[model samples]
Target: MRRRNQVRQSVAVSAALLAALFVLPLLVVAPFRTALFGRETPVDETEGQPFVSGQLDGESALRVLDGETVLEMDLGEYLLGVVRAEMPASFHPEALKAQAVAARTYTLYKLQTGGNHGDAADICTNPTCCQAYIGEERARANWGENAGAYEKKIEEAVAGTDGQVILYGGVPILAVFHSSSAGLTRAAGEVW
Candidate 1:
């Protein structure tokens, strides 16, 4: 009788220890979920999945405002769209290359400085605000027969200068450009 009681007690102790091994961790960790994992930002699931473009390639993504909608795309692909919208495809390749670098720099600068489009967007399509962005369909419609060639040119310019950005004081600089400036560029303080 004494031996049977000892065995039963041993079994009870083992079972309690096993249960604590699983339950205790969950109990201790549940309260810290918000602190450790970040608060969930509300998403507009009604809008469906956001549009994605280009090769993706595991690069960091940017959230852009496409008119009323928010679009997410890879950095290089975003630059391609910017270069297409901001510069003429008929321009010399070197000119396009310069524009690509400037656009990329400007984008990086905005990202680092915290974008103005609230937390929902990193940039917008307004030329007056962030930068102009030409969607693939609009660009195709505008270019007509030359759409294929023009798109390829822009892709080359972006790919050739991958990861390049303008820096001032070892940080990315806001490199801005305009359409057909009549005079040499003026300081921001002088103009704005």
Candidate 2:
């Protein structure tokens, strides 16, 4: 009986040590992880309040995924690229304005929500995953003769609607746009 009790106590101690080995690392790293890749917080009840500072400014940078590389660029510059890539510059100015608002809102929403890219980026260039973006050089190549004019137009759209985002229940809406939904809206359950 004495030998059995010793074995059982040793087993319990070993089990506890093994559990600590696994759990201690998690406890130590969790705070750092949260700090590195932001924590999600409930939206404030305040409505139409200006969002803190995820906007296009001298200090702001957006992480963009181009192929396997991630580049950080000025937020305003990034918005110009997104608008040009996502919308036809030939579209009406109001349409461009609406798209700009959506893009800004979407980016801000991602920043607030801890992002979907495994917490690596605030937004991405993949239209399927996040938003579509084209660098200035590519936009020029794609536009040819219209490059300068189209770039200016898109810039204006972004500037005109700067920091504006549509909110539902005090949170930025998903702000997703599709060219055509085959004459039917996608069921929410289907996409999410």
Candidate 3:
């Protein structure tokens, strides 16, 4: 009887230890999900998937707004208007009609990048590679007409818009949200 009790206790202890080892991974996975979402959140099943976090929001998504009428738009075209709107008014149709390089000083896509840091004309070493567009944080020029509180609102939400903006290869692409009247698009999405 004593031997049987010892064996039973030993088995229980081993089972408990095994269960803890397995559950340890579940605990670790918890933080990964938390980091992805930033918090525990329930998603709205009626709308769509809930966006979990900020970094994932800007990963390749877009936010849109309607001037007055509501409409769905392409992610690519929307982001272009943002980059353009976020740009100085110099990027307006009037200026877009002129040489893209005309307004150099305030222009977001200036031909020269200014000084490397109080040195020489900040010419790009590989303009053909990156197309040499420079901004302190891309540009305030990149934010656009629609105002969104969170980057997640730009992504998995905002199913409707006046327009939208998308990111490709870590670059912004803006396109037209033509609700029978088209908006903006670009050749390169980022450069043009």
Candidate 4:
């Protein structure tokens, strides 16, 4: 009977140690996650106000590299194209709005960081390099019968979230996003 009791205690202790091995890291890391990843600033701190970083204001023109040519266009116009290309027009308006904010924040971050193209432009049209973009004509051609409705939908999404951006530490974050995750997504730290 005493031997059975000792075995039960040993099993309990081993189970506890095994559990601790998994739980302890989460407990220790949870409190520091925000500190390590940076937290979003409170909305009250910046509510109703457009984020202006350095000389990059909401109305500032953006220089984009489309193929070998450089084109300068309004920030809103650029985001319209980015939203049209980066996300499907069939998505919900709210989702498109979120994408707009992320794309805007990313564009601002690139501008602040001196983007990959250096001197050539603030951003590029390549999805791999920066973000994908499709002009109104291309988007219309692709939409076919849904052109008018899709255009209106995309325009509303872009215009509705105009000047809004996701900010961290009072600055725009990189705001990377993907269209699909291939059934599973990995944490940023795991990939980077």
Local distance difference test, per candidate? 0.80, 0.75, 0.34, 0.83
Candidate 3 lDDT, tens digit per residue, 1-192?
Answer: 999999999999999999999999889888787687685343323343433323322333322223333233332233333323333333334333221212121122222233222232222222232222322123322433322222223332222222223434543332222112256655565754
The TM-score obtained by model 2 is 0.64
TM-score, candidate number 3: 0.20
Candidate achieving higher TM-score, 1 or 4: 4
TM-score of each: 0.68, 0.64, 0.20, 0.69
Candidate 4: tens digits of C-alpha lDDT, residues 54-172:
22334678899999999988788888889999999999989998998899899999999999998889899999999999987777767776777777777777778778888899999
Scored by TM-score, the top model is 4
**Error at 112, model 2, angstroms:** 1.2
Clashing pairs in 2: none
Q: Please provide, for model 2 over 52-110, each residue's C-alpha lDDT reduced to its tens digit, 9 standing for 90 to 100.
A: 32344435677777678888876666777788888898898889989888887888788
Question: Tens digit of lDDT per residue, candidate 1, span 1-192?
Answer: 999999999999999999999999999989997888886444322332333333432275889898899888788878888999999988888888899889988998898899788898999889989999887667867887676677777777777777777788999887978897787778899987
Which residue runs does candidate 3 get wrong by more than 4 Å? 34-192
Off by over 4 Å in 2: 1-59, 187-191
Worst lDDT 10-window in candidate 3: 99-108
* Candidate 4 ranges beyond 4 A from true positions: 1-58
Give residue 15's error in model 2 in angstroms: 96
Poorly placed runs, candidate 1 (over 4 Å): 1-58
Best by lDDT: 4
